[model samples]
Target chain A: MRAFLIFTVFLAAASAEHCYKEIEKACDPTSNKADSTPINCNAKYGAIDGVQSALQKYVNDHIERSFEYLLMSTHYANYEKSREGFEKLFRGFSDSKWNTAIDLIKYITKRGGQMRFPEIDSEISSNEDYEMYELQSLAKSLDIEKTLAVEAHNIHGLAARRRNEFHDPEISSFIEEKFVHKQADDIRALSGHVADLTKLLDGRDSSLSLYLFDEYLQKL
Target chain B: MKSVVLATVFLTCVVFASAQLQCAQKKPNIPTDWIDMASPCVKKMRGQIQEELKASMQYLAMGAYFSRDTVNRPGFAKMFFQSASEERDHAIKLISYLLMRGELTRDISHMIKKNLVVPKTEWATGVEALKDALNLEATVTKKIRDVIKTCEDPKDSSNFNDYHLVDYLTGDFLEEQYHGQKEIASKISNLDKLMDKHGALGEFLFDKKISGGE
Candidate 1:
């Protein structure tokens, strides 16, 4: 019984750690466009000279980004909503959801449209109101922000140029209200949620439970 | 004796040659602090969230005691205890996560205790606190991703078995995002309706809604 149990354990271990070669074989994409690399699918580490060593960084990077996306989605949503409510209550702003719309647009431009920008753009553009008009104009400037925000072959020059891009009062005000100030609060809230979920997920096993927690509560 | 010695040397040479071939095939730097990089940051982040949840739990508990709603007072107290327990569980899990990663956990008890200052009256304050929690999950999700990246960087190959740490962390991160993205946000978005629907039962659900319905 003992020998059988030990053998079973070994078999389980073997199957569980069935390295990249096996993963690669199982997950062949149909088109040649399927670019499979170590970054895409590999156990982050393997034993090297009996020492554990990780070969790739993509998994970690993706996981981190996924969390960041969750944070941005939540906090920015709340911050924009709160700001809208607050502005309506305090600042006498006509559109309560203006900052949120603008914030989403800026996020899409900067972070590659994680929350469906085209749909958002149409939504903003189609809204026949003065606030929508102002936000629509802001959306047009996203191209310039993208341009001035990035540069080929130089980080410092790009920073300097982007600084010039925001030299305009309208752009500066939009950024300050929607992105910069709002981002700080969003970031704080995101950090708190990250902490909570990290603690919860780290403890639990079973993907099903994790999935449920994520689906209903965490909202990742 | 001579034959045995020769056989041993031959076996050693074969093993050495195989290992050499493997190493020479892929030259990825193994970092010493890789595990530390992944673990310490995660631990730190987990500590912060645990603290917030703990504080929120205490606040709710205190709020329940103070609120004049006698019908749900006992229920709310029960919910508060459950929340505190869950937060404690989270703290333990954070510690376990650190241990699994072969990293030491910094003492976060004091920090958590200090932050546990919730309002005594949470009839409405609890709702606000829950909103804060929803927002908190969003923030933590971002930092956890950074920790995963830091761990996976080709440069730092720490000694702790990072074999599936990536998958584990990835799974955890996805779960985190889901919890925040779907569940809490929905609750906060529909807070007014939820409050109106359950009445007394709503107080219990609002106070104690576990992620997995557990």
Candidate 2:
């Protein structure tokens, strides 16, 4: 009985090795097995290409947001009156956006995807309107948040679509749980903050209101 | 045992035969219009490269001005010449990046045909030259920023942004611009302080200090 068990184990191991060798032969083009069948991975290749292209575009969006925030920071820094609080806020946002871009690139590379760096235009026209009141700047900030939320949604949709098409459960869960849901939560929280700030500033131009808002943002 | 071994070999051959299908596809030719070299942002970058070259020429002219027998400021001449080389290097870097991205036109002769405005060849004083150089650096910084801005999506309603291009610009160029401006500003401040202390004698002392490689 002991000899029989040992022989069974040996036979299984040999069979598995033979299967691995067959897979290796399929991968090699120069192998002269006339009767050998090929396994087409064209569908997988197409899926990868599609996802990579979308991810590249997504990366570009993140970079644009970062640059926009950077310009906003510069405006606050260089302005004669100088709102240091707003400058810090914009700078913080810019850093976050930049990091997000890096994170996305890392994720793509981890998945064996090639990254193509796109050319970017970094000028911000909104920065030219920096002379506007604190309320207006906040409005602009809200607009940025809204745009980011939309982007997050679009990315989520792409990931979900790819998952459905390719039946990639890992990518689906990763996109939905890690990115989509998180972005949605962020959008909700940001919207609430923007609304509260808008309400607080309604019919008020006092330095006190501005100071309070700045303080609130600093805490956030 | 021999029967088991023969059966395994037979299974492996059968599996290989059943799995056979052509995996290799003909290599697709790349489309000529695949890369958008004439995109507004790319065109702006190309123009900025020319601006870099022009800046290099201006620096060279400044170096020549300081090297004149009448000027007799070897240190200033050396500094300006180095600045010129740095600017030329910046232009070359931009060109190389563009080429890597297939954004630059293949026609090298067309790239050579630049309508660069000739830079002023003379400065009334060292202070004047320093101020001009500082201003030029600031302008170049602004131009670089503009290139970055051009990468942004113009359609306000859309969230599409060019992250890759911005990354390249910020990573490769902007830090250097900031540092260059800061250095020039410091030099200007020092020159101003020196002028305040000595008047005509300050200029004489400043020249001597610079010429001594200080």
Candidate 3:
């Protein structure tokens, strides 16, 4: 009876954590996609030595960026009547970043990697001198988006290269699925903003334009 | 929108490259901190944000409980989810108000609170959950009142009574809290009476009403 109970528990766990490779169903239409998603909570699934830690670093970075977005929002708070709009944009961005970090942490845990509660870095990334102007702020934000996109692209590349070793592909695919496309959308959106802001400001500081531009940002 | 097109054309600037914005330069920094509220107010305000967050999480849990297949009360789930969203908005409003007071250094630095625990996950009936929500709003109201009490009193040794913060919470947060509490209590009373008469069928009908029978 004791052996049967233990066997049942083992069976349940085995069904729970079926590895991504193990979930390959023959004659499925998605064969070409081969999207590296785990079908079960793979108990034995583990990553290459450095891949999980690298993913951990990005998770921490996203968490840090979330606060940075908040700090940026705070800086924009004292601007004018437009503070409401800037406040809306940065706070929303902050929430979205935190949500992304949360997703990454779950993925890490799912892949059998330990999530490190690393002591948060206190440094904020907003440049008070540069970001004061709406145009400048958008440009700086565009730069941030560009940096994050590049980093996501690079990590996705890393995961893809390491896929030959088995567990690395799943890590790569997780990054690709979660981070890559979002970064692309963010970059596109921010680039549009930078262009629009540049056109609106045209090397001049106009209070009315700033307020109007901020209102537009609030919607996003 | 027509006026916007012409404005965009005229506003287009022939300035330094976008790359300059990425780097450091001496363009005058305009800070928003017109007045920094006292330290004590900052602490209390931060605590209130956490309280709001806790209430949001509890509502979220209640929503999930009602959403479960076994308990499947869509009306209750919808109401709780809406309440959760409302609570989150309240937290954001408090945070924004705190920032508006130019006390960003203390509050923004300690931004998110960790490990928010929702005390209740399951309920015996719809009345039980409604009662829990009523209790929650009352607790939140009391917390807001306590913050107001400390901020308003001159003898607290802080030597600074933040009239603006006190007025803001009382006029805004307290008003919302009272309305919310009254609505929840009324619902509980109605649900109790209905459940007592027709049992689960009454609950089913009440749930429809709560979910906006329209």
Candidate 4:
């Protein structure tokens, strides 16, 4: 009887730990005095720094696996698994979180626009016809660079637009022509490096939902 | 005849015990719609935190871009950097919280793509900004706490183990509020001391120091 009772207690403990591994990870050791893991820091809290990583991780791992299976699927079982994963990921958000994420996604896509470039060195000595041909040649050489430059430019424009919309700054000619313009150029310059790389890459294409979900889910 | 009576009594007790167990172990029933609705609030809070982090980073950058030690007072740049880092941590924590809740988050780039600027003409501006930050933190704390309490209210408390989450979030809000108030108070007091020692020179010193970070 004594041995059986001890075994039962040990099993209960093991189960509890299995169930609350994420909560244990986030809990501050010094403050969470009641238990090595606090009961409160479970999936219910849904806050990120607290225990959200664990849940997200759990969701992410299974989703990825489902994706992998779905990618290779020839059977009904695989489809069901993928469907289940998709639904769970979709349903994971509370109404507020879903709306916010959708809004952000919409904002990003909406902000995607053509970014214009400033005129380069107009003073180069050449005949008008020669200059036109030379300009075309220069443009051809800068095809890849220009694409990246455009993206960088657009991203900056988007960021500036966001900033402008936030505070109703007086769109004075001086301010608009000088400060905001300069700021936009600076943004383009800052993102110039990454934009260049993005243009070159053509690797695996993951959906936005999958990417975001996977990033957070792996932690759960 | 005696065995039958005993068996009947045993069956009665078993039924009573099963009923008691059912009452004690009632499964939680969280409202699905509520979860969906509340998700946006969490996302908005996250967006706000991202905005704060961007502001803090801009402040640090401004200090770095413009100031020199001889021109400005000591420690202003360090303070801005510190504040910026803390806000970044706060943003990360917010993301972690959402991830834990199984809510998905896209890149902050989508929500906050622009470089935020904090206009700083002088040293006291940094201090004033810190005070404003503390007030914002306090506001966030209240809002998060209220969210938790609302979740706990019996009227809508059907979600299984959501109460547990509320409890955890409450702890986080308290800790953040403490940090915000403490840092703001410290910066304000430090600024006051600098003012007493150098007057206008002290003020300019702080401006260059913070605006042109060390």
Interface RMSD of each: 25.3, 27.0, 8.5, 27.5
Quick one: best TM-score, which candidate? 3
Per-model TM-score on C-alpha atoms: 0.30, 0.41, 0.55, 0.35
- Top-lDDT structure, candidate number: 3
Q: State the lDDT of candidate 2 residue by residue for B91-187, as single tens digits.
A: 6577556655555432232333222334487788888999999999989989989988877653344343667778888987999988878887887
Kindly report which residue stretches of model 1 are placed more than 4 angstroms away from their true locations once superposed.
Answer: A1-220, B1-77, B105-129, B153-163, B173-177, B188-191, B194-214
On residues A141-207, what C-alpha lDDT tens digit does candidate 4 reach at each position? 2342243335334333433343423221222222344334544553454245234323322223223
Q: What's the C-alpha lDDT at position A196 in model 4?
A: 34
The predicted structure with the larger lDDT, 1 or 2, is 2
Docking class of 4: incorrect
lDDT of 1 by residue, A62-181 (tens): 222222222222221221112122222111111112223323322222321111111111111222222111112123223322332232112222222344331223323433454444
Q: Tell me the alpha-carbon RMSD of every candidate.
A: 31.0, 28.7, 13.1, 31.7
DockQ of each: 0.01, 0.01, 0.10, 0.01
Give lDDT tens digits, candidate 3, residues B1-214: 8789877765563224422332222344667456646667777877888788678768866765676544657799778877876887787788678756655533354455443445667789999899889888988999999889878764445578888989899899899889878888888888789888799899999988877832
Compose the digit string of candidate 4's lDDT tens values, residues B128-213. Answer: 65565566566656666655655554233343335555666667756766876786677567776887867677566655655554
Poorly placed runs, candidate 3 (over 4 Å): A1-72, A78-86, A94-184, A191-220, B1-36, B105-107, B154-158
Q: Which lDDT value does model 4 have at B24?
A: 15
Give the lDDT of residue B117 in candidate 2. 37
DockQ-best of 1 and 3: 3
True interface contacts reproduced by each model, as a fraction? 0.00, 0.00, 0.04, 0.00
